[model samples]
Target: MNVLVTVTEGATVDDEFRIDGLAIDDGSLTTDLNEWDEYALETAVRLAEADLVDEVVTVTIGPEDCEGTIRQVLAKGADRAIRVWDDALERSEMLDVGAKTALLAAVVETEEPDLVLTGVQSADEGFMATGVSLAAAVDYGWAAVVNALEVDPDERIARVRRELEGGVEERTEVDLPAVLTIQTGINEPRYASLRGIRMAQRKELAVRSLADLGLEASAVESRLRLRELAEPESESEARVLEGSSEEAAAELATVLREQGVGR
Candidate 1:
């Protein structure tokens, strides 16, 4: 069995920052491997460590600037990495879920891994739909919000524990050649050690373009367009109620009454 883990570069904004039109100012943002993806990669590495899988590969759809993040994946435990990027992707303002699905679907076709793993959601966009969408695109079975996983290669089945709403947990089985969106807290992700980091430098990190994947630039053109970007409007104000407990309770009641929140 083989496993492919999908990862992405996630960005965090500075405490004080300004918007650069539709996006945040580049200088004020820091990028790294996504939080959720770390768990997904850890799951794949653990499978490899258990000798249940032959190879652990990671795929990403980002430009060359994200090579550092890809290196992190290698340093952790992926056998190799595939990075998909092109002029079309760099030119586009944004790649919607469908566009991303198409890109990933191409890689999935080329790799043909027995099991696909992805973070439940990207730290930046948080769409939380790519794993299922990719499964649909590749005609693979899929399960989402998976907190635990066990695979039987001979049986060709992936038993998964899904975290559902309201503290509910559902255990189910997905057929082989499937995609599973890994949820955080499934395991403790390890940091890249000094030796792992050195070894990663020698690992094969392949970069491919859409053309190499037999895809055209038109394949990445997104139908969705961003209309606007602005800060959310502040709708309420806060007041401090400082005094005896009884006095504070009375003030809270008065404030609630003023807002017509309670009778």
Candidate 2:
């Protein structure tokens, strides 16, 4: 069995964003791999190490700078890496659900992996749709928010436990050649070791284009448009109740009851 995972580029901003425009950072912060995607990749790597999967591959759809992130995936244990990017895509940093799905579907088609995996959501957009969208586009059964997975290679079946609201979990079995979006807390991600990093440097990171994937730039479409951006409204006044611990607890409980909470 072969598994493919998708990685996304996530950033952190130390200062305020450009509220008047798209609320984007001014490149003054730091960049890192998406936290959720790291968990997804770690799950894939564990499967590979356990001999449940014959190989693991990772794909990243971003600018060339994202190659570093892809290499990190390889160092984590993915047997191969694919970097999917184009001039048009690089120009439009934020892709709509349809566009991102199409790109991942193309990779799935090309790689023909027996299983597909991705982070439950991107750290930047937090759309929580890319994995399911790719599954739909590629016509595969999918499980979202998966916390655990088991695969039977001979039967080509995957049993997954999905996390739900209220701490409930649903277990389902899907055939092989399916997609799964992994949730955080599923596994702790490991950093790339020095030896693994050296091995990653020797592995090839294939760069793919939209054209190569039989896709057109115009075919990628966004349903939403950014009209304007602004900072969240700030509350100018909030009363602080000062008292001893016991008094504060009593007062807070009274306030909650008066506010129709926990009544």
Candidate 3:
């Protein structure tokens, strides 16, 4: 199996608020690999190491600064990486998940990977729609919020297990050349070993521009517009109950009912 994992250069939640002017874009804010994306990368690495996959490639669409993130994934055992550079992407203008999917679909088609994987949702946008949109663009079967995957190389089938309501799991099989959006906590992401980091530096990294993909800056459509960004209204302080345990429970239930949180 050959797998492609797409990652994004995302701002931290705080950074998002800061950029929106709810706060300040302080240098203290930290940025790193997205948690859900790490699960996808780790899953690909494990499959490669177990001999179930021949290679794992990581791809990201961002500015030049995103090269650090690509290197981090390469150090974790991806065979190679691809960086799609677009300066306008830095302003977070492509906020529509579908628009981002279109860009990724254009890249994935060129790679010709057997499977494409992405985080179920980005921590920053939390749209949770890219996987399905990308799959639609390429006309592939997609499994969303996948927790596990088993690939049958001979049959070219991928059995995917997904989470359902009430802690249940649903399984479905899709032909190879599919897309999956992986949920967080699917697996433990491996840290880059010293040896692995050294090896990553020598790996082939293909840098492609949007024009190389024959995509114009105006070709992608944005279904969403950010009218304004602001912090969520501050939550009111909680009130403590001054009564017995049973009374406190009753009060809690009353509060829930009043808030329409309980049926």
> Highest TM-score: which candidate?
1
Model 1, 1-263: lDDT tens digits are: 89999999998878777888989889988899999999999999999999999999999999999999999899999999999999889888889988999999999999999999999998777999999999999999999999999999999999999999999999999999999999999999999999999999999999999989999888778888877766677676867798999999999999889999887
Checking candidate 2 for backbone clashes, the offending pairs are none
Q: How many pairs in model 2 have backbone atoms within 3 A of each other, for residues 3 or more apart or on separate chains, i.e. clashes?
A: 0
Off-target runs (Cα >4 Å) in candidate 2 are: 235-263
Stretches of candidate 3 off by over 4 Å are: 14-28, 88-92, 240-263
Q: What lDDT does each candidate get?
A: 0.93, 0.86, 0.83
Model 2 agreement with the true structure over 23-135: per-residue lDDT tens digits: 56555456788998999999988888889998898889887887888888888888989888888876664589988888889999989988999999977678899998899
* Best-to-worst ranking by lDDT: 1, 2, 3
Per-model RMSD to reference: 4.5, 4.2, 5.5
Q: Which stretches of candidate 1 lie over 4 Å from their true place?
A: 240-263
Q: lDDT value for candidate 1? A: 0.93
Task: Find the candidate with the highest lDDT and give its number.
Answer: 1
